[model samples]
Target: MEPLTEAQRRTLEDLYQRIDERVSPIAGTHAWWPCRKGCDHCCRHLAAPLTITRLEWTYLWEGFQALPPEAQAEIRARVAELEGTQRPYTCPFLDRESGGCRVYAHRPMACRTYGFYVSRGTGNWCHLILGLVEKHGDGDIIWGNQDAMEDTLERLSGSTLSLFEWFATEGC
Candidate 1:
């Protein structure tokens, strides 16, 4: 609940850098890559409320504060409406009209690593990506290990909580 310490901030930033390095080369090189700005399929098809580490929530809050009052209000309303939502609910941070994340840059590692990472030797991505991989083959794609990334995040940040829980606790 406290502001991130200097060391924590640096470590999180380093993680971000590593993610960028891993994602950069493969971002647009392959036709099978379905992740892009305005492509919100992942956002729309979340299996559960997005869970994030304390460090990630701290950073995401910074981006939330920078938004206009109206935008923040809209997001707040959306979060409030999600209390009883079913599985595969849309992300509250998604800007429905634009089909983009409202806090893309500050989103948690889960969002950052979504389609680009593989878990348990399998791709952790959407149906679109699966279809593409089936047709074009996944040989050219550069995949980051989701399990490793998750371990790094846990080591850097400690405890984790769902986005809804964070909103409830922070009263933001």
Candidate 2:
């Protein structure tokens, strides 16, 4: 992978801004929004290896580069061991002890939009959110447009690949 061009960086920043714009209100107003920091349900029980755009990988690489060497090495080992892992595989970037993302600021669109976004009229959040919504009802929820965000990401990023694939081929 090549270094992101200035335009690409700018585009990523804009996309992130749009995501925040859509998510912030929901995160603030939802009666039982369960997506606070230290809530690692989604990270711990990933349904699949996260797929991300090249543009996202480029940005995520910047965050990976910022970590200390020891942390980087630990993440590399985790990725190496991810092969053949089962459905509930934990993300390598998650800090198990702290239950927070090691690359929270640089997480991919999927992570950023997980609890707030909807596609095909279905919420993409974890069971905790579902439970809360079930109990509180979804009348106040403002779901972000996942499909539109995906389209924009495709337009900006061009190509997509799984996080595992990115690390395996690109050498993080």
Best by lDDT: 2
Model 1, residue 162: distance off in Å is 0.6
Local error of candidate 1 at 31, Å? Answer: 3.6
Residue-wise C-alpha lDDT for candidate 1, range 86-120, written one tens digit per residue? 98889988999999888888888888877777899
Cα lDDT of model 2 overall?
A: 0.87
Candidate 2 stretches greater than 4 Å from native: none
lDDT of every predicted structure (CA atoms): 0.85, 0.87
Compared with the true structure, model 1 gives a TM-score of 0.93
In model 2, the Cα lDDT at residue 135 comes to 89
Backbone clash count for every predicted candidate, in the order shown:
0, 0
State, as a TM-score between 0 and 1, how close model 2 is to the true structure. 0.94
